[model samples]
Target: KILSYLDDSGSGRVDLGMFYAVVAPLCGGHLDKRKRVAFEALLWRPVNEGGSSQITKMDAVKYIKLLRAIYIPSQGMSEMLEVHGEADDDTSSSMVTFNQFLGMYDDSEWGFGIMSTVVKLETRDRNRHGNQVCSVCRYPIIGSRFKEVKTGFSLCNQCYSEGKVPPTFKQQEEYKFREYGSEVEAMKAKCVCFSMQSHKNPIAT
Candidate 1:
C-alpha cells in the first residue's frame, strides 16, 4: 500500500524524495510539520528536485484523495474539498501556494482530525521491529511484512510483491499469510496463537 502511493513512475523503484513524501507525513512532530510534508508531496515537482514548488487545483484534488483515504475516510471528495476551503467551481488552472495551503488548515476544523490521524499512524510506524529479517530475501523487513501462520516464516514487502516465499514452504497447497505493520501487532498475533494452542491441549490440573 505504501509503495502504491510512492511509486508514481511505476519503475518498481522509489526515489528518495518520493520515499520522504510518504514517510514525512507519518512522523512525530507539530501539526504544521506534517501539513508541510503533505503540501510538498503534492507539488508538481519538488523544489530541490528541479521543478517549481507550486501546486495546482488538480494537484490538490489528487493529493486530497490520497489523504482522504488515510485521514478522513468518512468524507467524500467534494466534502473533503469543502473542509479544506476548496470550492467545487474553482478553476483547475489556479495555482495554490504553500501559504495558501497552510491558510486553509489554519482556517478550518479538518486540521484537528489530521493531527490525530498522524499521531496514530506515527506511533504504529515507530513500533515496527527493526530486527526482523525476511525469511526469503534475508533483508531487514520494513513497512508491511507478511508472515505464514504455520511456520513463522516471513517475507519483506518487495519479496512478497514478487510472490517469493521460503523454499521449504514451496510445496504447500496454499499460503496462509498474515500481514503485520508493526511489531506490536505481530506480538499480539503470537499471543492469540498461544492462547488457542493452550485451549486445544490443556494440561491436567
Candidate 2:
C-alpha cells in the first residue's frame, strides 16, 4: 500500500520532512540522501529524475524538525543484538578479504585496498581530526580528492600516480602495509572495534 501524501502538505512548499515521510516512501533506503535529492530537485539543486521547483535552506531545517516525532536515542535497538550482544568472541576460524566486510563507495578504478592499505578522512585543513594509514602505500592519506576508505580492520588510499583504485572501501593503498589508525598521530582517536583480540579495551582512549 502507498503511504498517504499527507506529509507532503508543505506550508508553502514540499520541505524535507514531507519529502522524506511522503514521497520518499516510493524509494528505498533511509530518508537521508533521498531528502537531500528531493530538496535539490524541488528548489535547491537540480535533479535528473524529473524535478525542478527549488527550495530554501530554512525549509530543510524545518522539515528536519518534524522528524523528531519518530526519534529514538539508541543506535542499537535491535532485539537480537540486545539479547546476544556483540560477538566479542572470535567466531570465524577463517579469514576473509576486505571486500566481504565493507561496502564499496566507488567502483571505477582498481581495488582501493590493493593499491593502498590506508585512507584518511581527507580534509583541506592541517588539523588531523583523524587520519588513516593504508598498508598498500604506507603513506598517511589526507587530501580532499584522495580515495580514502576503510575496511572493518583498516583504511586504504589510492595509488593515484599508478591509477589503481580499491574495489571496496575495505582496501589498502598500492605500495605500503595497510596499518590501522595511527595511534600516535590520532592521539584522540577512539577505536570502534568490538573483537577482544583487536583491542584490550574497545572503549579505550
TM-scores vs. true structure, each candidate: 0.40, 0.21
Per-residue lDDT tens digits of candidate 2, residues 1-205? 1122223334444334345432432354443454444444334223212342433323332223222222221321332222223233332222222232122211223111221111122222323424554334656554322323343333333465455444553355443332323343333233333344476755667
Best prediction by TM-score: 1
Clashing residue pairs in candidate 1 (N, C-alpha, C atoms within 3 angstroms)? none
How good is model 1 by TM-score?
0.40
Number of residue pairs clashing in candidate 2, backbone atoms closer than 3 angstroms, sequence gap of 3 or more or interchain: 36
Q: Given candidate 1, what's the lDDT at residue 162? A: 96
Candidate 2 minimal-lDDT segment of 10 residues: 110-119
lDDT (tens digit, per residue) of candidate 1 on 1-205:
5665446458888545445554556676787787788677656244334576767765555454545544565663354444444446673667778887666545455432465665777665645876899999888787988988878798999999999888988998888789998888898988998999999999999
lDDT of 1 at 100: 77
